[model samples]
Target: MKSYKDLSKEELLQLQAALEAEYEDAKSKGLNLDMSRGKPAASQFDMEMDIMDVLNSSSDYKTAAGMDCRNYGLVDGIPEAKKLMADMMGVANADNVIVCGNASLSIMYDTISRSMTHGVLGSTPWCKLGKVKFLCPAPGYDRHFSVTEHFGIEMITVPMTPQGPDMDIVEKLVSEDEAVKGIWCVPKYSNPQGYSYSEETVKRFAALKPAAKDFRIFWDNAYVVHHLYEEKQDHILDILAECEKAGNPHIVYEFCSTSKVSFAGAGIAAIASSKENLDDMRKSMTMQTIGYDKINQLRHVRYFKDFDGIEAHMKKHAQIIRPKFEAVLKVLECELSGLEIAQWTEPKGGYFISFEALNGCAKKIVAKCKEAGVVLTGAGATFPYGKDPGDSNIRLAPTFPTPEELRAATDLFVLCVKLVSVEMLLAQQA
Candidate 1:
C-alpha cells in the first residue's frame, strides 16, 4: 500500500471520496461498539466466578492470624492480606504495603488529596503553595492526568521512550522547579504504550534530588502482573527497593489492585511505600473511616494465597485477553502497515495499543470512527487536561470487546484513519 502523502492531490481527493462513501455505508449499518476504556469483557469474568466461592457462607470469616474479618478493626488491612499484596508487588516486607478498598485508583486519589490538604510528611500543603505541577508523560494514563488536573495542578507533558518516560527531562524539571511536586508513572506494562522502565531509568528516578522536598512519584503498577506473552514478558525494577537503596525511601508511593485480575470494581487494592509514608497516610486514614472492608481483604488473601496463585490466575487472564489484543493488532497490521501516515505501539502485556495517526488527523479520525458506529477514547485523553498537542495519539482498548467486535470496530477504525489521512493530505495540497 502506497503512503498517502506520496499520492498526487487528485489521487488523494479520489481516495478520500471512496473512503467517505465506505464510511457512510458503515454508519448505515448502525454498528455500535465501544473501545474506550480498559475494561475486561464479560467472557473474561468466567474464570473469576470461583472468587465468589472463596467466601461462601460455609467458609471461615476469620483471618489466618485469627482476626475476625466480620467486625472491622484492622484499619491497615488484615495481616494476611498485607502479605499477599506485598508479595504481588515484590516487596519483601508486608509492613510497607497497606491494603485498601476495591480500587487502587481510590487509594491514589486519597493520597493526592491528603498531600493537597496536609502535605507530605510536614512539607507545606500543596493548596498553600503558589503553584503545583506534575510531570505527565504523554501517551500516559488519562485517569492519572485527571487526578492531577482535578487538584488544579499544572501538568507538563514529557515524551515517552521505549524504555520509559524521558527521565533526563524528568530529572531536570524536578531539580530546577520547586513547583514540580510530583510525576505520574505507570512503571510496568504502562497504560497505552506498555513500555516498562529500564533498570537505569528506575535508578535515575530513585536517585533524583527534587527541588521540592515533598516531591513524590505516583507509581501506578496497575498492570505489573498482566502479561500477554510468556516469552516477551517485561520486568520492571521494584521502585520501593530502589528508592530505599538510594536513601530516598519516602520519594515513591506505588499502587496496585486486582481490578483487572479478578473483578473490575470489587477486587482488593494496595499502596506500597516507606513505613514513614504509610504512617503519615495512616493518621489521615484514622479520620477517614472506621476501617476499609476487611472481609473483602480476607477474601482476596484466601483466594490468591500467594504470588504463585496470582500468577496462575493472571495466566488465565492472559489466555483470554491475548486473543483480543491479537485481533485488533492483526487488523492494524494488515490495513495500516507501510502507510507512513500513522504509527502504533505493539504492546506485549498492557490493556491498550497506542496508535499515533498523522499530526492533526487524530480528532477527525476519532470523530469519523464514532460517526461510523465505533467509539474510541476521545483523541486527547491519553494526555494531560484532555489535550494532545499534536492531536496524534489515540489509545485503543481491546480488552473490553470480544474478538469479533474488536475486528469489526478496528476495520472501521482503519477505514476512518484512511479517510481522515486522505482528507488531511488533500487539504495540505490545496
Candidate 2:
C-alpha cells in the first residue's frame, strides 16, 4: 500500500473524492455512537454484579484486625485494605499508605488544597508564595491540569517522550526554579497515551533535587493493573523505594484507585508515600473528618483478597474491554494506516488511544464526527487548559462504547479524518 504522502496530485484528488462519498454514505446511517470518556462499559461493570452481594444484610462487618467497620475508628483505613492497596501499588508495607475515599481525584484535590493553605511539612503555604508553579507533561491528563488551574497555580508544559516526560528538562527546571512545587505523573499506563514511564525516568524523578523543599511528584498510578493483555503487561519501578534509595524519601505522593477495577464512583482510593509525608497529610485529614468509609474498604478487601486476587479480577475486565480496544485499533489500522495524514499510539493497556492528526485538523475532525452523531473526547482535551498547542491530538476512548458501536463510531472517525486532511491539503495546493 502506498503512503498518502507519496500520492500524486491526481491520485490525491481521486482518493479525496472516494473518501467524501464514503463519508456521505456513513452520515446517512444516522449512527449515534460515543467514544468519549474512559468509562468502563456496562458489560464490564456487569461482571462485578456480585460485588454488591459481597456486603449485604447477611454480611460480616468486622475487619481483619477485628475493628468494627460500622464504627468510625480507623481514620486511615483497615489494616487489610491498607495492605491490599500497598501491595497493588508495589510498596514495601501498608504503613506507607493511607486509604481514602472512593475517588483518588478527591484525595489529589485535597492534597493540593491543603498545601495551598497550610503548606507542606512546615514550609510556607503556596498561596503566600509569590508564584506557585507545577510542571505539567503535555499530551497528559486534563483533570490533573484542572486541579492545579483551579488553585491558580501556573502550569509549565513539559514535552513528553515515548519513554516518559523529558527527564533532562524536568531535572533542570526542578533544580533551578523555587516556584516549581510539583509535577503530575501518571507513570504506569499513563491516562491517554498508555505509555509507562521507563525505569530510568522513574530513577530521574526519584533523584530530582527541586529548589522547593516542599516540592512533590503527584504520582497518580491509576492504571497500574489495567492491562489489555496479561502476557504483555508493563511494569514500572516503585517510585517510593527509588526515592528512598536516592535519599529523597519525601519526594513523591503516589495515588491509586479501584475506579476502573470496580465501580467508578464507589471504588476505594489510596495514597502512598514516605512515613513523614503520610504523617503530614494525616494532620490535615484528622481535622477534616473522623474517618473515610471503612465499610466500603472492608467490602473491597473481602472481595479481592490480595494482589493476585486483584490481578485475577482485572483479567475479567480485560476480557470485556480488550475487544473494544481492538475494535477501534482495527478500524484505525485498516482505514488510516497508510494515510500520512494521521498517527496514533497502539497502547497495550489503559482505556485511551491517543491520535495525532495533521496540524489544525483535530478540532475539525471532532466537529465533523459530532455532526454525524458520533461524540469524541474534545479535540484539545489531552492538554493543559484544554489547549493543544498544535491542535492535533485527539483522545479515543474505546472503553465505554460497545464493540458494534465502537466499530461504527471509528468508521465515521476515519472518514472525517480523511475528509479534513484532504481539505487541508487541497487548500495548501490552491
Candidate 3:
C-alpha cells in the first residue's frame, strides 16, 4: 500500500474517484448508523435486565446499616453504596465519598456551581475573583470544557502526551497563576484516548504548589474499573492517597458513576476527596436539596453486590463491545495503515477510539460520513471549546452499534477518510 503522501496527482485522482464511488454506493444503502457517542447497545442492555428484579415490592428495603432505603434521610448515601463506589474509584475508604444523583456530570456541574457561589473551603468565590482559568488537556472531554466555559472561566489548552498532560506546562502555569483554579482529568481510561496518567504524572499533580488555595484537580475516575483486557489493564497512581502523602490532601475532587456500568441516566454517581473537602461540599449540598435518591443507590448496591461483582459485570460488557472496537480498528489498519497522513490511539479499555486525520481533514471526513447516511461525533468535539485547532482528531464510538452496523459504519468512515485525504493532498499540491 502506498502512502497517500507519495501518490502522484494522477494516482490521487484515480483513488479519489474509486473512493467517491464507494461512498455513493454506501449512501444508496439507506443506512442510518451513528458512531457519535459511546452509548451501550440495546443487546448489551438485555444482559442486565435482571437488575430490575433485584428489588421488588416484597423485598427488604433496608440497608446493611439498618436505614430503610425507601426513606429520604441519608443525604450523602448509604454505607454499602459508598463502599462500592469507593472501592470502584480505588480510594482507601468510603469516609470521604458522597454518592449523589444519577449523573456524574450533574455532580461536576454542581461542584463548579458551589465554587461560583461560595469559595472552595475558605478561599474567595470564583465569581468574586478577578479572573479564573483552568488547564484543559486537549483531545479531552468536551463536557468538562463546557462546565468551565459555562462559568466564564478562561481555559488554557494543555497538550496531551501518551503518558498524560504536559506537566512541565501544567506545573509552571499552576504555580504562577493565582487565577488558575482547577484542572480536569479523567486519569484512568480517559475519554476518547483511554490514556491513563503515568505514576509520575499523578505525583506531579499531587505535588503541585498552586498559587491559588482553591485550586483542585477534578480527577474524574469515570473508567477506573472499565478495562477491556483482563491481562493488559492500565493502572493509574491513586490521586487521593498520593495527595495525602504529598500534604495536598484537599487538592483533588474525584468523581465516578455507574452511568456506563449499569443504567446511563439512572445510575449512581459519586465524588471522593479529603475529609475537609467533603465536609465543605456537604455544607453546600445540604442546602441544595433535602436528599438524593437513596432508593436508587440501594438498587445499585443490591445489583452489583460489591466491586468484584461490578468487575465481573464489566467483563461481560467488554465481551459485547470489544468486537465492535476491533471491527473499527481492523478497517483502520487495513485502509489507513501506512497512509502517512493519519494516526490514532488503540486503547485497551474505555468506550472510544481517537483518530487523527491530516490537517483540515477531520471536519471534511465527518461531513462526508454524515452525507453518506452515517452520523459521527463532530470532528472537534474531543477538544476544548469544540475546536480542534488542527481540525485533525475524530472520536469513534464503537459501543452503540452491533458488529454488522459497526462494520458498515467503519467501511463508510474509511472511505470518507481516503477521499478526504486525497483532496487535502491535492489542495496542497495546487
Candidate 4:
C-alpha cells in the first residue's frame, strides 16, 4: 500500500492498468445504486409501522388543552408538540418554538423569504438592500446553500473543523461587513462531516457583535439526537440559551424535525428563537395561512409523546444504520488507509461521511463511479454554487443503501478512487 504520490512512473502505470481492468469488470456487473442523498432505508421505515395505528377514525381529535385539532387554529403548532420540539432543541421554554410542517428545510426557506420581503425585526427588507451575504461552512448541507443562493444572496466559504466552522473568520466577516446577514450551521452532527460545534465556538457565536442588527445564525440542528454509538455522542451548548446569556437572544434561529425519525415526507418540523423574533415571524405567518396541519401535529404528539420517546425511537434508528456506517468506514480504512490518496470522516451521529480526495481528482472519481453503475452526489455539491475550490471533496451517503448493496457500491467506489489516483499520479510524473 505505497502512497500514490510516492509511486514511480512505471509502478503507477502498472497499477493504473490493473485498476482499469477492475473498473471494467465492475461496469459489467450492471449494478444501479444511488447514494446521492441522506435518505433512510425502507427497513428503518418498516420497523416503525405502528405510528399509523397511534391515531384512528375513532380516536379523539381534541388536544389535551381541549382544542379541536380538526378546526383551524394553533397557527404555530399544538402545545404538546411545542414542548416535545422545545425539549429536543434543549430549550426550556416552549414559547420559543414554532413547529411547522414535515421538513425543517421549508422553515429555513420561508425564513429567508420572509426576511427578503419584509425584513428582520423591522430592518430594511433584504431585497431593498444593495447586497446581502451569508457565511457558508464548506462540506456543509447543499440544500442550505441552495436556499440562500436562490434568494441571490452571496455565500462566503468558511473552512470546517471537527469542532465546527473556523470561528475567527466567522467573527471577522460578521463584525466587519454590514452585508453579512447570516450564517448556515448544522451545530450538532453536521451534514457530510458529522462535526459538532465546540462549546467555545458556540459561546464565540453568541458573543459576536455583528455590524448588521439583522444578522442571524441559521442553526439547523438536524441530527441533534442521531447517534451511532450510545457512549460516543457529541453535544454542544444550546445556542438560544447561550445567546440569551450573552444578551443576544434574538441572534439565532434554531430548527429541527422528525423527517428522519419517523417518515421522510411526513413529520413535524420546528423553529426556535427569541420571543421578539417569534412575534415578528408570527406577523408574517398569520397571513401565510389560517393554520398548518394540526391533526398531524396531534398525531406526532400522540405517537412520540415527549423527547424521551423520540430519543428511544432514534436509538432504534441507530441500531439499523450504525452497521451501514461501519461498513463504509471499514472499506475506506481497509482499502484506502495507507494509499495516501484520500481521507474520510468517521462520524458518530449523522447520515453522511465526507471524503477528501487528491487535488483535482474528485470530479473524475465521481464520474468513474457513475460509469460503473454507482451514482454519488456530485463532486462539488458540498460547497456553495456547486463549486469545491480544490475540486477535492465528495460526500458519501450510506443510509439509503442496504448492507449488501452498500458493500457492492463502496467496492466499486474504491476501485474508481484507486484507478483515478493512479492516473493522476502517472500524469503528474509525465
Candidate 5:
C-alpha cells in the first residue's frame, strides 16, 4: 500500500474518483449513525439491568452508619459510599472523599463556580481579578474546556505529547503567571487520545511552583478502571499522594464516577483532595443543603460492595465496548494505514479514538461524513475555545454504536478523509 503523499497526480485522481463513488453509494444507504459522543451503548446498559433490582421494597433503607437514607443528614456522603469511592480512587482514608451527584462533571463545575465567586481556600476571587486563565492541553475533554470558558476565564492551549502535556512549557507558564490558576488533566486514559501520563509527567505536575497561591490541578480521572484488558492495564502514581510527597498537599483535586460502571445518570460520583482542601470545600457545601441523595449513595455502596466489586463490573463493560472500538480501528487500519494524509491513535483503554487529518481538513472531513449520514465530534472540539489551532484533530466515539454500525460509519469516515485530502492537494497544485 502506498502512502497518499507518495501518489502522483494521476494516481491521486484515480483514488479520489473511486472514493467519491463509494461515498455516493454510502449516502444512498441513508444511514443515520452517530459516532459523536462517548456514551455507553444500550447493550452495555441493558447488561446492568440487575442494578435496578439491587434495591427494592424488600430492602432496608439504612446506611452502615445507621442513618436513614430516606431522610437527608449526611452532608458529604454515607459512610459505606465514601469507603467505596475512596478505594476506587486509591485513597487510603474515606474521610478525604466527598461522594456527590450522579456525574463527576457537576461536582467539577461547582468547584470552579465556587472558586470563581469565592476564591479557593480564601485566595482572591477569580471574577474579581483582571485576568484569569487555565491551561488546557490540546486533544483533551471538551467539557473541561467549556467549564473554564463559561466562567469567562482565558484558556491557553498546551501541546499534549505522548507522555503528557509538554511539561517544560507548563512549568514555565504556570510558575511565572499568577493569573494562570488551574490546569485540566485526564491523567489516565485521556479523552479522545487515551494517552496516560507518564510517571515523570505526574511528578512534574506534583512539583510545580505556580505563581498563584490558589492554583489547583483539576485531575478528572474518569476512566481509572475503564480498561479494555485487565492483564494489560496501565497505571500512574496517585496524584493526591504524589502531591503530598511533593509538599504541595492542597495542589490537586481528583474526581471519579461510576457513570460507565452502572447506569449513566444513576451512578455515584466523588471528589478526593487533601484535608485542607476538603475542609475549605465544606464551607460552601454546608450552606448549599443539608446533604445530597444519601439513598442513592447507599444504593451504590450496597450494589458494588467494594473495589473488587467495581473491578468485576468493569470487566463486563470492557467486553461490550471492546468490539466496537476494534471495529473502528480495523477499518481505519485497513483503509488509511500508511496514508500520509492523516494519522490516528490506538488506545488501550477509554471511549474514543483521536484522528488527525491533514491540517485544515478536519472540519471538511467531518462535514463530508455528515453528508454521507455519519455524525462526528465537531473538528475543533478537543481544544480550548473549541478551536484546534491546526484544525486537524477529530474525536471518534465508537462506544455507543454496535460493531456493524461502527464499521459502516468508519468506512464512510475514511471516504470523507480521502475526498477532502484530494481536494486540498489538488487546490494546492492548481
Candidate 6:
C-alpha cells in the first residue's frame, strides 16, 4: 500500500526480494502469453462467423446499381461500401471515399509514398524537395511514424495532451514552416492512450493557414467506432466538415476500416478526402491496379449492411473484449494504486491502455515481463522510431488474450513494475 518512493533502502530490498521470488515462480509455471498487438480474440471472430456465409456460390455478385463485383470496374470502391465507409468516417459525401484493401496502414503508406514521388495536389514531390518534415504526436501510433520515416521525411515530435496534441505548438509549426507538410492524428479512441480530440482542437486544425499549400492532416480514425462502453463513448468533431467550413476543403485525409469490425486481415479499408485530393489519388490508383477486391467489398457491404449494422457489430466486440479491459484495470488498481511509481490511462473505449512507469523503468519492466514468459508491445513502440525519450511508456493490449490469460499477463506486469520500481529506488539510495 506504500508508495515505492517512500520506502527505505532496506524495505525496498525486501520488497524486491519478494517480487523476484514471485517472478521466479511465475516463470516456472511456463506461462507463455502474448499481448503484443491489439488483435481480436478467437471468440470475437467466432461471433462474426456468419459473415463468411453472407455470400456463397449460389449468391448474386451484382451491386444494387448492377455493377458486377466479379468484374474489374469500380476502381475506387463499390457505392454501398463507400457510403458505409463515408458514414463511418463522418464524411458527408460518399464521392470523397475510396475503399482500399483490408489494411488502412497500407493506404497510409501509399499516401506517404505518393507524396514522396508525386507530391500532394501538384506540389513538388517530397523527394525532390531540399527538406520535408511531418509533425508526430508522441505516445502516438508507431506505424504512422514508420510511414513518414520510410519516405526520408523529417519528423518533429509534438507533445500529446488529453484533448489532443498540444495545439499551440501544432499551429505554430504548421503556420511557420512550409516543410511541415502533415500531422498524424488518431482523433477518436487514439492508439495507446484512447484520447479523443476536442472540438476546439479540431477547429484549430481546420482553421490553420499553413505555410505550405499542400499541408495536410493525415487523420487515422481507426477506432472511430471502437468503443468499450457504449454509453460512455467519445465523439470527435468531423475534421473534413470542419475543414470545409473553414475554407480548407483539401486539408485532411480521413481513414477507417472494418479490420476490427470483421476479420482483422480480411476486412475493408477506406480513405475520405476532398474531391480534388480523391481525384489526384484516383489517377495513381488507376495505374496501381485495376481495382481492389470488389468482391470482398461487396461481401462487407452485405455482411454489415449499413452503418447501424456496423455499430451493432462493434457493440458485440465490446461485449467480448470489455471484460478483458476491466480485468487489466482491476488488477492494476488493486496492485498499483497509491504506489506513486506509476500512472496509467483508463480508456472508456479502444483496444489499448497506456501505462506510464517510473522514469527509466519501462524497458526493464517490459524485459522482466518477457523473461517471465509474457510478451508485451515493446517499450517506446508508441513513439516515432520506437524511442520513448523518457523510457517510461508501455502500451498494454487487452483484446488479444482471453480473460484468464489477460489477468495472468497483467499480474506478471504489475509484479515486474513493483520489482523494477524497487530496484530503481534502491539504486538512488546508493
Best by lDDT: 4
TM-score of 6: 0.99
**C-alpha lDDT (0 to 100) for residue 426 of candidate 1:** 80
Model 4 per-residue lDDT at 107: 95
RMSD of 3: 0.9
User: Candidates' lDDT values, in order?
Assistant: 0.91, 0.92, 0.91, 0.94, 0.90, 0.92
Greater-TM-score candidate between 1 and 2: 1
* Per-candidate TM-score against the hidden true structure: 0.98, 0.98, 0.99, 0.99, 0.98, 0.99
Name the regions of candidate 2 deviating beyond 4 angstroms: none
Question: Residue 56 of model 2: what lDDT?
Answer: 89
Q: List the residue pairs that clash in candidate 3.
A: none
| Comparison by lDDT, 1 against 2, better one | 2
lDDT of 5 by residue, 121-161 (tens): 88988899999999999899999999999989999999998
Give per-residue CA lDDT, model 4, range 1-430, as digits (tens): 7788888888888888888888889999999999999999999999999999988999999998899999988999999999999998899899899988889999999999999999999999999999999999998999999999999999999999998999999999999999999999999888999999999999999999999999999999999989999999898898998999999999999999989999999988999999999999999999999988888888888988888999999999999999999999999999999999999999999999999999999999999999889999999999999999999999999999999999999999999889888888887877
Give the per-residue lDDT digits (tens) of candidate 3, residues 1-430.
Answer: 7899899999999988898888889889998999889898888788998999998999999998799887768889999999999999898989989999999989999999999989999888889988999999989998999999999999999999889999999999999999999999988878889899999999999999999999999998888887888899999988999999999999999999999999887899999999999999989888987788888998899999999999999999989877887788888998889989888889989988989999999999999899888999998988888889999999999999888888889988988888999999999999
lDDT of each residue in 5-35, candidate 1, tens digit only: 7889888878878888888888898898999
Candidate 3 local lDDT, residue 324: 80
TM-score of 4: 0.99
Q: How accurate is candidate 3 locally (lDDT)?
A: 0.91
Model 1 bad stretches (over 4 Å): none
lDDT of 2 by residue, 88-144 (tens): 999997999999999999999999999999999999999999999999997999899
